[model samples]
Target: MKRRVLIGLFGFNLLRQSSAHHQQHCLSFLPNPIKHCTSIRQSLPQGAMPNNVDARTMFSHIIKASKLRIISILMDNPCAEVIVVPVLSDNYAYILVDPDSKESLCVDPAEPRIVLEAAAERNVRLSAAFCTHKHHDHSGGNMELQRLLPGVEVYGSCYESVPGVTKGLSDGEIVKFGNLEIRCVKAACHTVGHMLYYVTNPGNPELQPILFTGDTVFIAGCGRFFEGSADMMVDIMRMLRGYRKDTLVYCGHEYTLRNLEFAKTVDPSDSVMSKLSWTERVLSMNMPTVPSTLEEVCTFVSSPTNSTLRFLISFQEFQYNPFMRAGDLKDAVNATSEVEAMAMLRSMKNRF
Candidate 1:
């Protein structure tokens, strides 16, 4: 009876491949890793699509993220069991939980009413608020929620006031709550001290690790450069790649469709084309596309094969791909030594 919704904003691309074209669309539905999430994983044979190794592998992994194991909590199924509440403009607030314990955490709350209503409906306690950064859209409801629910621990970056932030943490600090363990990562580019929260339940390691990557990282996209430099963001992304491949990524906004459109201009090809098509389908359904895995994200954004995609990809692009641990990619991003990534980001921002 728990209701949930997932939202995603993919990279932007203007080229619309004919919908009628019979190119094998990788359409395996990953189960909703939220309360209303319902998905089944299907694996298509490899090497099926020419010019799209990254898309094929990435989508395949995404379907895997949707596959549920044994449901030990609220519902009798294994899938994403949470709620997506829309907040300021394009942002979304999420309620993540461990069904069996009835313990839950709120991610980037923008409005208290939506969270309070969801909590009341389930008769569950809101023990923690995991914030991605200090932006208002992501943390506007923090203070309100704290006022409404006494004792809910608010977690965020050490650099800014995250509304209800009860704990000021640094990178690599791990906190335990209920059956979950969250690793705090310093994702400083979006905000000088922005942080991404990665959560995992020790009791169910099979469940993918979930990352609340606020404005720093997005589905098929990344946040606009603000406080930190491009190299800083790149280093942070490399650190994220250290986690398991199946980690689930829950970001702050719904800009995936538009992000993908922009990516096409940078790298116009079949890989971007197919992925954009898939993004359109998700948007069409009006479903949230968060809770994506690290592996899938890396495949789409970090793989060297999509060099053209790199031009359109901002230095913040590193925020989305944690698998670039080698640091070699950072060099590529910094190749144009004379020109600062932040300066380039500023130029792009002016255009917008």
Candidate 2:
């Protein structure tokens, strides 16, 4: 009798598995495009997707047909949302999704496996990848991801050697994916040919604009002057000021703690600087320090007065006293000969 009972239970589970598999296959037929730009639904108008979607929708039909019983027994909570994976020790590669149509968009992918695993877990179809800049950490994963998902659109400012660049994006060009319309803004201060993507979904205006600044800007600090000038950065800041104060700014790198510390040394009296100490500590714990605001940029580091040119000691006016104003510093630097500037920078760095 015990043997018979065991056989019956095993047979029951097999039947349940078959039923679940069939249900999942039926869900696939309900319109889930293998790529993001292609809408799965037949009836909806163009471009309707979210920046993120709960994972349940990926396998909802199967869980429903099984009445959530067998799945609950086999897996963790059925209502648990998908986990957004972090990669490269700092970069957050995300799959922006539209569940109704099963369309998806990939943003700044830094690792192929991390993104592939998440998409496989949710059965999400990846559409295109929007690259913010040419920095390797930001664009390196595109080649491998494209191999896994063929014909995926890689959109960004024209890079001479970037792989999978089906569309060469330029400043002010707007690209659409589901409900999101992303405007590519030329924000090239960190690199010679960098751009930022300003993402907004009209359906939810309250969500605010999402600015992918790449290495051009950071939370408390901005990118180092690599291939661009302070004048160019100031111009970019002026253009960025057009966005609302609450726009969410996502930048490349995880350098908030270090940046805030550096900012404090520059502008100690600023209230924004005083308040960001806690922000630094939070980031030090290996958390994301981005999605900051444009208001914070003005308050913290994004103004003409804080121009990187002024920060470059060789370019700054040498002041006899610590309390000397930036104007005085600028004058002093301008007054110095090239030899004097070099000597001053060496001495200051040694002291600094």
Candidate 3:
């Protein structure tokens, strides 16, 4: 039996509106032969909520309000699946599979057994592995998985030493898997040789792009600077901000709640955080709080002043640290440059 999947109508509306708006004002830029796409909508129960009421409803409402266009569909009842396998406390390993072809790829597999079990259960053949960075928790299973699945292609950063890495990927390198094109971008900061993967369905613009951000970025929080500097992180954020607003981001960890807790301190009056807190409560009970849009992450990372205060409050343990006494961050506080602000934040986090 094919289970019906209820897709939020937000993305559809955005795409429709954008296409219409572009057609009117910017016809030349708009590509010819635009494809009209439709998705199966989950029927809303009659009288589910009064249309005029502004009361909070399901998390789907939040998504609807965001008005983001659909980038990709994860499930169509056995057609394809993005299976999230939780391993080693808060780490997440994802399996992207096309059920019809029995072809699959595992991303950031921390534990080989867990990833193997997930593919086995789905009856899919693992053909490739993608590692975002060299972190033990993210690439630890690469070697083992390669051994188990002979000839499995493992791709990782050209700058980093990834175990069992058969092909080293440089920035802007594209790897094709069926209809999906995965682009690797250098996103150093958390690690000196960190890489971020962006997967897109170029043949179908209606499909959403997916970003596999290792520890460089997370929900409501960025990763700690271990090998790179605050400058690198700032650059990474700017680069990420350039991506399509609707791109769905799949980060490496389940740290949304904790990150939001810190965010609350930074902007106590932010309504978005409040709404997100509710959604986190509901979703975290059963699933990982991820697949956040690029726009959503920008919302959290923007406003250097707010972020500075947030970090100060959250990292009070490092308030008296010597690094805090340095005048280097003074320019950052004045917003002289975003790099300085990010540097200050990273420095504080390091001491924390």
Which candidate comes out best when scored by lDDT?
A: 3
TM-score-best of 1 and 2: 1
For residues 102-209, what per-residue lDDT tens digits would candidate 3 score against the true structure? 468989977766677656654577889999999899988898887888898999998979888999999899998876778899988788789888877665555456
Query: What are the TM-scores, per candidate, against the unseen true structure?
Result: 0.66, 0.59, 0.68
The model with the greatest TM-score is 3
TM-score between model 1 and native: 0.66
- The sequence of per-residue lDDT tens digits that candidate 1 reaches over residues 185-292 is 887877887888777767656555667788877765667677866677556655765777666667788877776675564444455566567567546644455555
Residue-level lDDT of model 2, residues 1-352, one tens digit each, is 1100000000011011124334211011122222332222211222221223222112211111122121101111111111234566666565555433457777777776567656665567787887777778888988888898888888878733455567888778888767667888876656766878777766555444667777776665556557765556556655665676656566676666665454345445444344464454334433344445555231221113323311111111011111113222344445243334323432342344
Residue 114 deviation, candidate 2, in Å?
1.0
lDDT, candidate 1, residue 229? Answer: 67
Least well predicted 10-residue stretch by lDDT in candidate 2: 2-11
Candidate 3: C-alpha RMSD to true structure equals: 14.7
288: Cα error in model 3, Å: 0.9
